[model samples]
Target: MTSPAIPFVASSSYPVRAGNRVRPLIDGEPAFRRICQAIEMARESVQVTVTFMWAAFEMPDGRGSTLDVLDRAAARGVDVRLVFWRPDAETERHRRNAFWGSAAHVGLLEARRSAVKIRWDRAHPGFCQHQKSWLIDAGADGETAFVGGINLNPHSMVAPGHHGEGHNHDVYVELAGPSTVDVHHNFVQRWNEASERLAPDGRWGAGSETDLPFPTRIPAPCGGATVQVQRTIHAGRYCDGTAAPGGHAFDVARGERSVFDQYRAAIDAARRSIYIENQYLDVPDIVDCLHRALERGVDVVLLMPAEPDVTLPVSPERRAVLDSRARLGAFANFMLAGLAGLGADRRRKPVYVHDKLMLIDDAWATVGSCNLHRYSLFGNGEMNVSFAEPDTVRALRCELLHEHLGRDTAGLDDRAALELFRRIAKENRTKRDAEDPAWQGLAFELDAATHVG
Candidate 1:
């Protein structure tokens, strides 16, 4: 079956840049602002892929609203195309309250009437288009792509302990280099595939076919920066009523393998140091990887939420995994204790890694939705971006390691180490509780654990 032609710009006509400082937007406000700035500066087309989107008029800085801006941009002859996951109408109530409602659908409907294109990613039922990114036209100069875990929703931008609190930690990268093209290409592929499936005879929704128009070519930014685009997709399940002739589509195991392969390749390439920040640190393979790296004399530091979302009662199997994680923590403590013994005066520290990020060799870094757990790496639809920019990567690595070591200098006394660890645990726990009152018990447990010994 011949697929629809994917829109593309001639590579030769546009100039590309390399060796640029890829800024990491740490908070949601910065991320949203950067996105708006890129959109405002867009001269031709805009493409956005997200897991969820909420329609709201009230946003920080009164930056006019998400829906209003998108509509206006489309009206100005800017080719705007958005691909998003379509949640079941039944779940709309819960989703609407959680922040990301059917805004993508609503926004797309409005845009479609205005001659803008919209596509729903019906790749796999129950699985989502979990990538959060946007590509804006930089004219013939180049394009800017924002890739990260931040969903385009209001709840994500609020502070950690606000009235509508959520565990909204994320990192986004703004790319104005060669990597942006690759990111743009990926979006085109997914959009085209979605458009095909959403056709009248296609298998997306039981309705009349709709065609979304998009640009053929986008300009490339001229500079020196290399960025690599990586993604995870669900291939086994047939969401479009199409069977995998090779039987490869029936094997859910292959998706798991792909995820593991990507992660292991990245981990094996690390030289010097690996810093990660994640929501969960319970995955055995990931833990083992760090342990092996530490044995090889690589500096590994992780920042994680003090308490995980296992606050609601869990199954015996899940409980077992959590217990095993605690045991692993004990093992890490034992290793650190041995290291402390050798130094005599230096303090020993237990690793409580979180925050789902990793910076290696001060040149390569990765940030995304994949956690250090089997469910995230192997079971669910996840997205991550990995790139190398010496200055930015090195700066982030230094900042994280500085906090881990308790100072800018190398010498860290035992007292300081203990205090630092305690503070981290305490702050994370407090934040978790403030987000969810049910997490109060977890906070207490964290405090007790830090106080013990």
Candidate 2:
């Protein structure tokens, strides 16, 4: 059956673009390999928006560190551009493993004699510039872009088919098509209006802080998948009045919440099942939508952190949402689970689920850095590309589910696949409780009541 054409995040700054190709890179090692390869092949530029970067992150197969990767690209005159988050006083405490443009970081760049240009951007004073993206060969025929929640740290650089100590499970989608122009536009917008660009210590590299012109020509289509680039921009963050290629000028003074809007729309539009993997799910309205979907008999599965930080109730909304998830235990159509890694020693360790993506009805999906939380949906500089092509969406679903279930779900329908996921996860949970290492896969269902309570 052909899926209905649903309007995807209509309020985005960029229009829906067709003839695109998307490939999901499931774990950090593979993702970095692909990203580094693109950088090595970059002819025009390599633009990266960084949130958290550690000095420990190195490229695959002796390619050197993260900085080394960018530096090598710059040495080849590929125009490497990096935008690092500049946390203010309020956000400084949370700057863990981040290359937040500190003086020491700058000195390291100087000491290494690196040629990579750097710009430091801040989010709405107290929030975050939590966008992790890459644009390779921007505007060129082989243009490409990548978006996801993967961070540059050792905890994220583990091999796939996890079986080891605690690691971060994440994803990134490689994009090629007309839509790659939007990524180029996003980088230019942020680079030009970087909050600290004028500060004495705001930027690095001589004559590298110059503003970029908005793209005037859209890249030709590359495939059949349709995509819409969406974002969550804070009001008054960028008042430069810039816009993407072939899109309306953004209402920068008013802000945009297309990620939040798209989450609601996608959940509400689900007909078969909704598969979500996000680091956190503390948004009340989103939980309400999930509850309603379960009531409608739509299979719903959410994979998140095994032990997320729980703060004392600060707002009534916070308490209400947690209570709502606790109530999800009563819904038979819902499954709440966490990912785990089994060691060769037959030990179980929770693999932090840091992926922020959703596949709905095996026909639509979104992959990017937008978490199902207020920070990402409301304030952070988040970006996602929502696509509505069954072939592309289903391929991603099969790949991800096969990794988690150790079984091919391609033969099963969406609903049946989710039911199998629930059964296997429940079995894994019981095995975990019995201290047995024999389980079908790494996913193990959790008691929503206890996990959320």
Candidate 3:
């Protein structure tokens, strides 16, 4: 299939490259199932980068814990490598161990005899290493990649459209063809730098100074779509290497904020519609651009969590979470909704909107770990993959709306679909206020100003 023409100008930070096949995997069941399958089929190696993980999370489908699956793959002679963010020493007391610092995680690794390599990477203090991706069969034919915001929390293991305690609505894309090469490149880049940090102590899972080699060239395209792998990486974090200037989809500089630039460009160029599903909607520049798109008669729809989860302190003092909520309360001129799930008992429960996604005019889309917050936009180490394929964007948009509205967006244009969503959301709010039994699985308007305060 020929790729659709992009109406907007592409950012120099992430130039569009062609020849990729991408499939949107909704919720944890499908995403994790596919991830395990790819690991099982790996011919050479599997590389995974995750910001947060829980030792308690077992695959809900009975395949065992995440480590078990990876161990099994490694036992088959597949090289399995993982990198998890190691919390700074000061903040370690208040957070769960994402690395080998905890006895349980170390014991888990020690028990497994497979040649699974794990590394702990430290990000710029006070920020997170918040990119999550999985690459299988790197540097070979049949290579594939999965990228998005699905974390290792048990809550994220729930299937789509189901009501469970701590239910979440998220997305991950399974990619094939040349796009996997970029994912492979990112993993190697981070692993190399992380190894340098570990070399001094000869600990933290960096057994040797030599790390995985960067792919000498981009892999051959296995399909029809085009992709641009983008990132927000601070300078000096990757001390061992730097991205040279030019047509590369990412930049290595003192402050490379390509993810933010891409979001601004995509929103500014939106013509007919804008659809977003994210955990936070508080970035000033992004909000301003969305407001302008609204003024231009673009239909705007945003989905966020009805209740913010501040279960852990993202900062030393745990004040950033509150600040984020305050910032979210200040947006205007855009239609916003808080999504909730209904149960068999007809109870309304918030379905945590953990997806970082945006669809502009059904012609452009992005999916990954970067949220619309200052920390994510300009401070953290984040990654996102975007494409200018209308059919793929439209299908993913329809699928998400259908899950949120409990009906298909059949025969509706992008603008019409958003408008219909607005109507259903308003009606659902009224029904909930009236104690109506039918207000089960609909999104309701959010009073951003009053929601937090």
| TM-scores, one per candidate | 0.67, 0.97, 0.89
Task: Please give the lDDT score for candidate 2.
Answer: 0.86
After superposition of all CA atoms, the RMSD between model 3 and the true structure is 4.0
lDDT-wise, the better of 1 and 3 is: 3
In model 2, the runs with Cα more than 4 Å from the true position are 1-3, 310-316
RMSD of each: 10.9, 1.5, 4.0
The model with the greater lDDT, 2 or 3, is: 2
lDDT string for model 2 (111-226, tens) is 99989889888999778898899999888889999998899988888778863576888999999998999989989989999998999888998657688888887888878888
> Could you say which candidate leads in TM-score?
2
Candidate 2 TM-score to native: 0.97
What value does the lDDT take at residue 273 in candidate 2? Answer: 92
Give the C-alpha miss distance for residue 314 in model 1, angstroms.
Answer: 4.1
Candidate 3 has an lDDT of 0.74
By lDDT, is 1 or 2 better?
Answer: 2
- Tell me the number of clashing residue pairs for each predicted model: 21, 0, 0
Query: What lDDT tens digits, residue by residue, belong to model 3 across residues 292-339?
Result: 777676778888888876443355333544454444334333567888
Off by over 4 Å in 1: 1-21, 88-94, 97-115, 138-140, 158-167, 195-225, 236-259, 269-272, 311-317, 331-355, 398-453
